[model samples]
Target: MEEVIENPDRIEIEVTDVTNVIKPFKFTKDTSKSSLTILNQSIENIDIHEIWNNTTLHICADGGANRLYEYGGDKRSEFIPDFIVGDLDSITDEVKDYYKKQGTKIIPQLSQYASDFMKSMSLILLYFNGVEIVDVDEYDGLSKLMNQLNDKHLVNINSYILNGLGGRFDQSIHSINQIHILNQQYPTLKNVFINEQDIVFMIPKGRNLIGYNSISDFYKGNKFPVIGLLPFSPCIISSWGLKWDVRNWKSSMNGKVSSSNGIVSTNGVIIECDEDLVVNIER
Candidate 1:
């Protein structure tokens, strides 16, 4: 008997086209606030300098160090991550050495159960809270660290800019899971996952204004940016304030997916939803 392997290229193409339908509301760059930037697999269209200067901390999740090292040059001083964390598997020895020499804290978590992305997230929590990374005996100890950070009233995360999604399917979904988990656990933390052509994030359950100063805030000077209001989770959702607005529309994997919707309004857009949903903006 022969085993059949599914072609990932086909799946990626399908999702890319499916996700590109929504038209986005844009905003100008502030260039002053803080952001934690993650260099994952795909980081082509991002303005590394803009994100680096505005963000207060930098973190690389495991092999993400490689992407950072490759994409970042003498600009290393500008975007040096405050901490590099992961299971220590995919990260190359050369990349590790380079960051170590630069005085970046390397946390070797030898747990196969937890993914590198999750470990990186844990480190971000610690850094934002101003807590020291105490050595732990097992990866399960991550729960303890979270508890300690919470008990000490030290979890102070505001917003984060994540790079590299739209590459590997599982990793991309994992990133989406982090968005929901972080929002549920730490409502104070705002997460925006950046890819080569788009930025993906979640809208909390309620009203949200997808506002922007000018369309150029995202596209330099192109036409209106693409946007989508997606219902990727298992929940059924109802939404308002869209060009093709839905009234009590039931959304789920087994139901309709709002993948190719567009934004027709000119002065920003608004979306009111009964449940939390995923939103993507074309870069």
Candidate 2:
């Protein structure tokens, strides 16, 4: 059965760990829901304010806190992350104390087993649940809070927006992995990763119409955002909508792949496929 609930405050999406899954999505003004901006080490200072203004939640991963603290300077108050989380390895004492004094919660999850990115995600989930952080060092305390909320079915999540992608090749790939992992593991959370230029999201399997006010809405008339029908998984796939649109195009890491494709139509674009695929829009 399909379920739809009224949540004017957020957008919910499901993603998978497999690469090259093409699900359909439409970029509309109404689709602009709550944002979750993640600042990694690769982030730049120029767009910090813009991202901060557009997002409802701000998060800094391990070293991301240091970047924010340094780049945020006098404008630091304007872009304070609601929560600063990680293993506390790269986070400096001065940065931690500074944000804490500014009323930001510093969560230190020393579990080397889990990635700092994963811990940050847990904090985001907690924030959406409206749970105050009285302690960060209790044994499995955050996990216990999550479990209790799950038991009572009181977990509420907003659309998550991420920044700082396409920098380090491995970390960028890891970010994409989280995209698929969250979709499969926590199918209720909505996510978007914003890079230095474009916005990235997943399209689930089936027919999807990507409507926009204009192609220029995302790109500024230079050209349609660069798109790709990436097949990172073992499964072969095909795609449509490109200067060289494919018909029954079987794609995989080892087979024919679509990359560096541009939007040609003036009105909008349409992408249809049997599996989920990743879409990139150059900003």
Pick the TM-score winner: 1
**Between which residue pairs do clashes occur in model 2?**
15-183, 16-180, 21-276, 21-277, 22-275, 22-276, 22-277, 23-203, 23-204, 36-161
- Score each candidate by Cα lDDT: 0.62, 0.60
- 182 in model 2: Cα distance from truth in Å? 0.9
TM-score of 2: 0.77
Candidate number with greatest lDDT: 1
lDDT tens digits by residue: candidate 2, 1-283: 2121222211222222333332222222222334455655656534645446655677788778888877877877777777777777788889888889989877777777667777777676666667766676733456656664464443434444446465678877887777777766665555666666667766555555554545546666554567766655644343334555555556677876677777664444455557666667666
lDDT of 1: 0.62
lDDT value for model 2 = 0.60
lDDT of 1 by residue, 193-264 (tens): 766677788877765666554445665533345667777555444333344555556677677677755444
Clashes of 1: 8
Tell me which residue pairs clash in candidate 1: 22-226, 22-227, 22-228, 23-226, 23-227, 24-226, 26-212, 35-55
Q: Which runs in model 2 stand beyond 4 Å of their true positions?
A: 1-33, 129-134, 138-140, 148-164, 234-240, 266-268
Regions of candidate 1 where Cα sits further than 4 Å from its true position: 1-33, 74-77, 136-142, 152-156, 233-241
Candidate 2: 10-residue stretch with minimal lDDT: 2-11
